[model samples]
Target: MEKTYTRFEHYSGDRTYQNEQLVEQALANSDFDQAATQGKGFCRLLDKAYIFQDEKLSEYSIVIYTLDEPGLLDSAAKREYVLSEHDEMIIHRMAVVRNGQYLDKADDVQIRILDHEEQGGRGFLTNRKKLSLIIKDLHLQDILIFENTLVSHAPQAGLKRDFKHVYQEFPDPFWFYDRYVLRTVNQTSQVMTYKSCFFRDAQHQVIDPIAIDLPIGESYVFEADNFTTDYDPKLEVRPFIDFATKASYSKVSDAAYQIYEKVISQNSTWLETSAPDLLVELAQHETLDEKIRFVIEFVQNSIYYVYDAEIMDGHEPQEPQITYESKQGDCKAKTVLLKSLLDYLDIASTCVLVNYEADYFIPFYCPSPSNFNHVILKIAYQGRHYFVDATSRNQFGFLQYRSVPEFMYYLPIEPQADLQFREPFWHQNYLVEETVTCMVTEGVGQIDHTLLLRRQNADAIRQMFKNESETYLFNCYTTSLYYNMCLTDNFSEKELSEYFTDSKIAIVSDNQDLNELQIQHDVTLLKPYTVRIGKKEYLNYWDRTYLDDKARDFNSRDLPFWLSHAREKLTFELRTDRKINDKEKVTLQECKIDSDFLCYQTTKAVDKHGARMTIDYSVKTNAAIKGEELANYLSSDKKIRDNNFGMTIDLFEQGFFDKLKKSFVKK
Candidate 1:
């Protein structure tokens, strides 16, 4: 593969042959009347067409563009397209329009095909590669034109193989990209259907998907002009049409389910050899949930995640015995094995396909096997079923307690199963529980912080300890200690590092019976009283910097924020031996806030020797807030924040005068 792309000016692929006559026809049909923007580079014409023929879908595209400035040369020359091993791309023509003439450079264009090395580190055993088209001598004011076609070699004619994707806007800031047409010709006789999803346009208005049935010949066509670039990362609705054959949803679902069952049935000898040992191991747990936990751990910890090229191709999963014996499999492979184990235990479980990232949009899509990108299992333990990812590691708990992916929509492999939805709920009470105790002993502040993590937080931190050392943990906490002990903006960088370097952190406990991780961190502040620029130092509270910092990340965005850090509860307490209260009877100030999705409260009390301000904060819900509800959430946050206590300091200024009087006599 490397050798094929080593030569600079040659074709990188031998799979697709070029047709000159077809290329000329495509170019001649791409004439645009709209004038290009004068100052910037822009695409004058783009023609993308798809043909569903002979049980396969082929994609062909033609693009013509020009650049006026030399600044756009690098970007113009380095145009690229990502391709997987299952997909083939062929370039039919490449030429430049110089003086109203086509200077053909199709054979001499520089081409480079590079494989993805980073995917290996992410545990996605993929043969995905990139194809780069490096046009040589790409100069100013010269129109560059190219034609290409793509086809997937995967078995699309089988049980699950139809899809349609659409884009209303481009990513590039082209001056004029409206001269574009996207067409699909269904050469097959099957009647394909598609659904509509609305997109938000530049004026903040919704653009509903245009559903146009193909001509009487049943060919679907979509054409658009003046497509603008969408810059918001949160805006992610891509209008699409579905072209799956009018096959029944249940039929497709059952066909895929049968393949999984067949793999287990044909490999009966595997169970004969492997089941007895697994059963003997499962028997040690004595309880059903524990037995299930054992099997899940066995798959997660024992079977490694290695995504082969065949993953998610709607193909048959490997035999359970094979995955169990090899201790390595993709999402589908590990999931099938886990499902088999549950089956052997007389536990009912089903396979689910999800897009781990954008699962929230799954139910909106038409029924098709091509929608999902990842596979997991939904186990029925006790009386309920919840998702469990086989590719996850170090996750241990009951079904709901396990820290699994926050999946929204799923397609079950059960017979007649349509799309399924998972309500956004945190099965466990607390994703993270932490207690910060500040003790003022002998005129110094000794802070003790203990964190108890469950669910996803626990699993994540456990892996942190597995991959990082205690020293690394302390370095991370140093920043936290700095912000907690001193006013953030009041201290210099050197002062922060000098004062907080003495912090100590240790993983006090881990996987306590493989359930949760408990960590302890301690920091001692020698000069707890410090008001910058004053030799007389003092303690200050109500910094509110941390609260403002967290809110700043979403101050202006309208995207439905993904709430991964929700369901966390934290408590901070301060204690000291000094006498500051005048009498035994003292007053306490408190503010309680209960919002739509969270609860927060702060209490301040002064003892005889010292004062303590305790803040209890928790995000109660896991559901994401839609854009319409964002302003209300922010308003509620403001109400809670505004009730905060004013910044207060100890009687440090008065003590500073006492220290000066005692300094001359004591020395």
Candidate 2:
């Protein structure tokens, strides 16, 4: 079991390996320990890849050698391969080797094929098949080696499939001993581009591949040995790495637009048909915004989203009529339907592809149709461009939805249009205004709260109110009261609904120009404003700043933080029956912090009977706070925190015995 030599070797042509000498050579040149622990087992040796290219076919072969421990028997015993018909890729060979001997026994291996549809999940229809294998008699310290080959058929005319962009990492971080060799041959007339870089030290250093022109075709080779190390915390927030190779296209967007064109051309016939009666009726609204909203809502709510990856043919979208008839489709289908609806209304709209995740790496990689995962509709109306995601059921205000991140890149699929990355306009006019009125009577308190939300905030709140169930809404309010406000008493579902219904105010008003939604509600607490300590009663008002938690310890973070541009105002009015002394009044003060990135203000007023406090806060920037700006941002945050954005009052009630004692002491 103590065989010391391990090596891996791959040849360019149809040559076959004779023995284990290649594996020994690879192990001798590297500092990899074969017996080291790597998760379940050690991948002690890797003769990774042997690729052969021609004008019509591209073939790839990979061989992996594993040293299994007691717990890692299954790791070397089972394997799975994914093959797709759409890519015209197939597995040509698979086998297992043990020690220095090939496992030629048929009883030692089992193979099974499963269609992706039978796997049961929601995703793009890949039309892929899985080949699974299980090997028996796998034991500890066993060198289990397996080899497989894949051949990709040449793509048909007008369909660009020769675009090869291969990204492989050598000396994999998870493998105790790993090696890689990638060789690519371009048999076609198209020029091939290849690039490679070491992970840590190769910043801004470009390494060009050495290309050799053979009698039949050209070949490009790349080899690397990667070592892992601790990275700077600031590097965590850096943009994605631009490392990839592409052939047959100059720009990444060019390849992407070609795929988009194919998909759009195949589905454009659906737009020529007439609109459905329901859509026709909905489109008869007086304003363009109304018609747009009606169509968006219908598509978002009426159709179900089901992604059948088994039947999906590459990036092509299904016909709009098919989606409408089936009442189910993925993002592409929904976007196609939405675009068709816009076509019927004579509105200019296009399908735009976007990556919704905040930390997407597609921008740095070689551009291909696979980069985008989500599709949204972009419309030009009233001299403005608006982006709409019809796949989402909860989005409101069409273009003013706040859930969509600002400054994300998007690709619009349109003919004669520049295929470049673009960003949506950053909206900053959203407002959230809250007013609370409190009254105390006989140790109990009644609180009335009113909120006016405008623009993006209004849309979000409206969608929440519309979609959430009554029980869910009640739970949300009760949870907030209990955790944030320290209100322990709970209300039943019926009682909570009744309280909401009684205190709810209508949205009607004379100011028809206003685009804000007004919500008013009232709640009664058993002992809302005071906590008794012996004979004295202390006021229990809590600080109400929404951003207090975010401001706490923000300076300690190494990465820049993102602050969405928004304006918020909160007002509170307090009234109590207890006798109030002049000195007992809450202090009246105004605090303000103004910077290029943020603006904040807080004002307080006190009267003989009650007091009122108002706070105005706004973020002026929508970017990350880094370097010197981080200090300024933290300064503003500290000012807001120190001013007591949610400061509570420290008022106590004096008893008759305490007043008499004070009077006697004064005499």
Candidate 3:
């Protein structure tokens, strides 16, 4: 829209964005019918551009929202954006368009900067901030413009010029149109090339960004005007485009390995200074597998996970000696330490890079360290390769049976390689088995819940046991049972504390080597049958939501539901110590629902005397669910939710209840 775009030339700080021409252009393109169709505040403009000037990549975005109704004024005061501590954000423009005149509010606006540590509890300590701007006195049909540019700084020391992997965000989830453009000027010695994935050309074929060769100072204006998005844009893997000088995936692998090799060589004391105390424990075990297990255990447990903005994280591991002395490192440092110990023990192992979120689409991404977000050690022993993540603390046992993230693709740090399809190596079992048993004695019911967890869930529970107090754990169990039994989301602290007065929890069994954990949660309720009378409903244990939310990610016609990520199954057993002689209520029927997303099968079994009722629900993970099959899948999901697993129990014999009170009183 402007010649030269000189404000973006040197990338300073806090420049007010002004482009009235571009704003008018985008507003003219905005459709009123689409805006009315959405029935919400319509977005007039969403112009995002990536201007790569050699080693630096600065993203300039200008989003303008038109408040169509007075109701949307509340949202106007809540305009805020997050900024990384290291990066610089430029508030280019802040203005409002009314009656074809711009009210310049940039100079007078008072924006509050807040400490936005939303996920600090999850152990991720990123120094990011949230800036909130207040727009006062907003009216109907007023177009508010917010323009800013974020100058992204490279993560760390080694890869300054290496433009490896970059994630591009998707269009805003509005019914309006947006623009995505990329402009660059290569002012370096390296040849500049770009690769993008997931975008389709006019022929409906997957567009390959590898073939795109941009000359010096070339401007790439990617047009996506008529595109419509129905699914959550956050979950969608938007066009993943990155610039890299490397020719192929093989070259990219070679470059990465060379960097690692050089770093290891520079810090060769890790190999020469003899094994540390943590690694020396491997000598106590005779077998190679035992020694490998010891090494893995030492790195996993000894070194706690600390997150840094490690891009494969910053693409370089800390010096092994530093990591060992500190006993804390990110995924890259931990894996490097584990690999070093394996080398000391004369074991053959290598570090692998993978992306848990992208799963299958990783193969389509350009070969760069940025495509991979996690690192794990892959041990080659006894004619097979077993992957183990150093960040995982609670996993135990031999290398083969040990659990790992189900990333569908992995790239090993070798001389040359491509993204290889990873097959299942870890043993698969029921991740969780929940047994809810209710027994009544003297008009009081004791509902005992035994949870048997394996693998990933086992690891999670072990963390809870280690970190949380017994009282906290007991309260958690009580809260869970209260929610499931009552089937309500509404919670009052006063009532919850008063309810479940005699709740107790105990760790029945915990075997770390086998990766199994079992806990019991029991609560005594007074006349629970009276409160939950006539066809008591129970949730299907794991799938408790009203509808399957994962099904919505594949809402688009092109993207498929990534099934490799959904590898765990839940087995729930519900029982009651009461007789159910009614043939209609206890017919012992087995129901099965097969859909493209998942297969759900449930069975009801009763004892010979009909004294106890046990209902079981089971589902096995399958392949990816394509979008075309989502309708049938959603129908099955709706069917399961609509019929909320009702179980009718005979609390009393016919006419026995009415005679009890009268007979006892008169005699």
Candidate 4:
């Protein structure tokens, strides 16, 4: 049985080639037919118009030459050729001619001629003419080694090959590039050879392979040079119509306008008198606070967030009528409804496409819709723009979580509206206040803490907590300890069942030595601060620093908000004030005993007494003393957020109660 060989030609320009006859003729050749029957000789055309070898071949050479017009190579017409090899070969401009036929098994013989961009002439090795193929051990190793050494030793070399690629911009858009190579190999051996071009451009762009068919033990080398280009800043921003906006509101395109016109045309007096403009009418409320509060309540109570299912159901962008039909949608739907309400009221609003996680307000030269996975609304009122995200709960007025920053928002004002993105704003501060009081009786302790927070900085803290909770469980340890170990609340009780429902249990203890302990803490943040659970035990563990991955690496200097001990302006106080009041005069001696910052320990007397129980207590929180000055005398390692000082009181009014709990019994 005879196999067949098929040859295809690739050419640049916008035209098609009918090569059926040429392919049929080529298939008739005995060698071509032999190769084809063996499932070896198959070829595909590329953009640059050249004959390439596609099938695997271990003991064969691939000869590809650019064709003339009409995609055909005429060797007799003008004797003009880009690259041609006939009785000899050239590697890096170094010609090598075999004196005799070089024949041997093709095992362990690998050759790779990578296609690259090299405009100027480049070469390293001179011609090594009349070479010999030293073959041995049923392997074509010597001849292949001789061939590779000549090219590897060369300094300046270039290859000849190019592949074609299709660049698509989605929904009826495509561009093309020519870049690829021809491969050859023997049928019995796994070794292979690649012939391609040499490119000088460092920014190497290549053709996409339809399917890779390389077998085991085959290798390829690609030589890509540095090609650089200056970016035209004008390409940074583009205008994409987000129809859900005040400007886009019209009877033709917007659903709200259509509904409004239809309702009014019916001559319904009730709708005319009761129906209010949804946009500017709301903004005209007597107070900004009222408008904000209304909007928050309307969105939070009215809409339910459904994520995965909504996106997966292939829901199209809802028209105003459709949104009103469901009375709820996802983020996009919520945004559109809000926009319509504001639009009816004549409020200026714009719907922005965003990748909530990516932070669109931050300058990203690579503008991509993929980066923006979510959407938000920006409303302008009283010469100020407010960012409204209805996806969250408990948000009011202009209050944003600490995780949001000035740069994470994109107003998406008209395309012509000069909006230059900037990096995250630094130097923002957060203030948090917490007050805790603990009362311990016998082995049981009861504590109460009140915390107040103020928004004073970029919302980094809120975002930090979100990030930690989602991935690393930053506050898990503190919450768990309180619910489990501290016995602040009983696990079997029904009153506080909701407190620890979200947390997973790690350990359970039923030790009878444990006393009933109650602890309550209230913490408030005026500004978003990364929520710290209890202390900075695992500072960097599980914290994914995207700033490092997206832009530059992180360093200490990059942490501009870092706190230092010397610069700390903080106060933390603990005190126990004891005073005994006497009612029956002289029956029992009246005394008032109080101590601040008390500590208990066993001590040895130096003079005569060997051992004694010692109690050391001191009072330092005078309310008048400067927090910074007081911190100097306390533990240097401990710190409190803001200048808030802590105070604790543990007084023993009667020794009998204490003695009852202890082993000592009065005789």
lDDT of each: 0.63, 0.55, 0.61, 0.29
Per-model TM values vs. the true structure: 0.82, 0.75, 0.69, 0.34
Give candidate 2's whole-model lDDT.
0.55
Candidate 2 structure quality by residue, lDDT tens digits, 503-543: 33334321212346777666665555544455444333344
Ranking by TM-score: 1, 2, 3, 4
lDDT string, candidate 1, 1-667, tens digits:
3333222232333233244432343244333323344353456667777666544556777777765566666777777877765567767667777666667876667777887544465366556787888887877876677777776553644554443332223344434564666666766555555554544567766565443444324656566665544544444443445544444556557767776667644524456677678777878998777888888889998888887755556556877888888888888889989888877778888887788776655554555666677788888776887678898877888665777667567778877777766676533466667777667655577888898988777877877878987667765665665655564655664565565546777778876444678989888766555565655544544435325334435643433655554355555655555434323222244667776655667766665555556555655344667665655556656765663532334433446756686568668
Q: CA lDDT of 605 in candidate 4?
A: 21
Local error of candidate 3 at 32, Å?
A: 8.8
Give the better candidate number (2 or 3) by lDDT: 3
Q: In order, how many clashes per candidate?
A: 7, 10, 6, 85
Backbone clashes in candidate 2 total: 10
C-alpha-based local distance difference test score of model 4 = 0.29
Q: Which ten residues in a row have the lowest lDDT in candidate 4?
A: 537-546
For model 2, the run of ten residues with the poorest summed lDDT: 2-11
TM-score of 1: 0.82
What lDDT tens digits, residue by residue, belong to model 3 across residues 483-577?
Answer: 55553433454466565658777778987666788988778755344323454422223235324667744455556665433233333333343
Candidate number of the best lDDT: 1
For model 3 the local lDDT of residue 565 reads 31
